[model samples]
Target: MPGEQQNTSELTVEELLHDAAVDSTDIEVFLNALTRLAVHNLSHPGEELLCGITLLRQKKASTVASSSDRAQKLDEIQYDYADGPCLKAAREQVLVHVPDLQEDARWPEYRETVLEEGVRSILGVPIAIGSGNAAGLNLYSDEKGRFDEEAVESAQQYARQASRALSLAVRLARHRDTEADLQAALESRTTVALAIGIIMGQNRCSHEEAFDLLKSASSSRNIKLRELAADLVASADPSSAGAHFDR
Candidate 1:
């Protein structure tokens, strides 16, 4: 209803991307929406285009989202060979365009496989999201020369416009991950403390002595300290063994 009066084509790139980010509930959902948007907005009329997004974080590249299953499979082929236009664009932060895969000689093995998949032209545009992280927008077309100069420029511009929303999504995901990690740490500490308290009650020993006993048992059993603590707590009181935090 928000765009009922105005056609989607009339929407500015910023508005489109902002709507995508706001509509999504998580990073994965937003990326999927972005790939779908790319295929819809960037593709020429009557031209079939498959879009995929490759994200590079901490020097690792992964296909984060795709407009279709075929696009996802195409992106995975690049990962299998460890060299492809998308990966190259993301790593070098440059655009890589293969107007005709058959004529391209850069990635011999990669080109062969991609050609077999019926992709004739490929365009990879790097998304500039600052902070040591990189991403690339990959477009696959069955028609050779599908991504001509004008099309390439359009794709590049789309990537530039999409970067801001993507950066915010990545930051939100990282924050969620950090919070989850902290919660897990607190739960583990609580479990260990409860286990130590049980040990103290059973042996009538000091807190340090109880902790040493727990550590010695954990080492002897070749089990992690956390696991050992969990087991001890469970054995002592099944109902109260579950990790509980005040927050």
Candidate 2:
């Protein structure tokens, strides 16, 4: 109803929550959906909205999704130059409104590049996830002064919507990453256990002594317990792993 959004504003919280639950397994898919939904709800004729979201990871920023290549290209320009409205919005946790790229002296290098590419205006609104991860939703236009007071005011509403969905997606991604790390730790512990068992059987040593031997070998060889265990397991023959451990 707002632009060409199919009345996304009318979507009940329950409905949004239900859809989010369905996408809990894939945060990228969920984040992309949120960007598309925001663009659809806020786009206008002269504005010709092309939207993208930049995600900050490990002190680096990358454009994760975009409604069009136009937005993606602009994101790259900002990233390559390492300074732009979008970066400020994400890093400073403030809204950055660039009325005209040609006249904006805030980021001289970025301004010249986008201005050459026919970009007239930009609005970067920070998407706060509340988890110390910075992100920004960027909207670009080809017409100067497209994002006036009323326009920005309306866009703020969509920014909040995108932020909510993206925040949940971020949490989902973190949960998935945490689960993977735990699984890896469990697997590594299991490998060490198996290695210890092999050492006990081969060396006729107590369980504690076997573990100590494994630790000694790990430290001596400058290898991880998992790597050493894998090597031992690889060298196992039908005869005995005793010879392997002796090495």
lDDT of each: 0.87, 0.79
Total colliding residue pairs, candidate 2: 0
What is the RMSD, in Å, between candidate 1 and the native fold over all Cα?
5.4
Cα lDDT for residue 23, candidate 2:
64
TM-score, every prediction: 0.84, 0.83
Backbone clashes in candidate 1 total 0
Clashing residue pairs in candidate 1 are none
lDDT of 2 at 27: 71
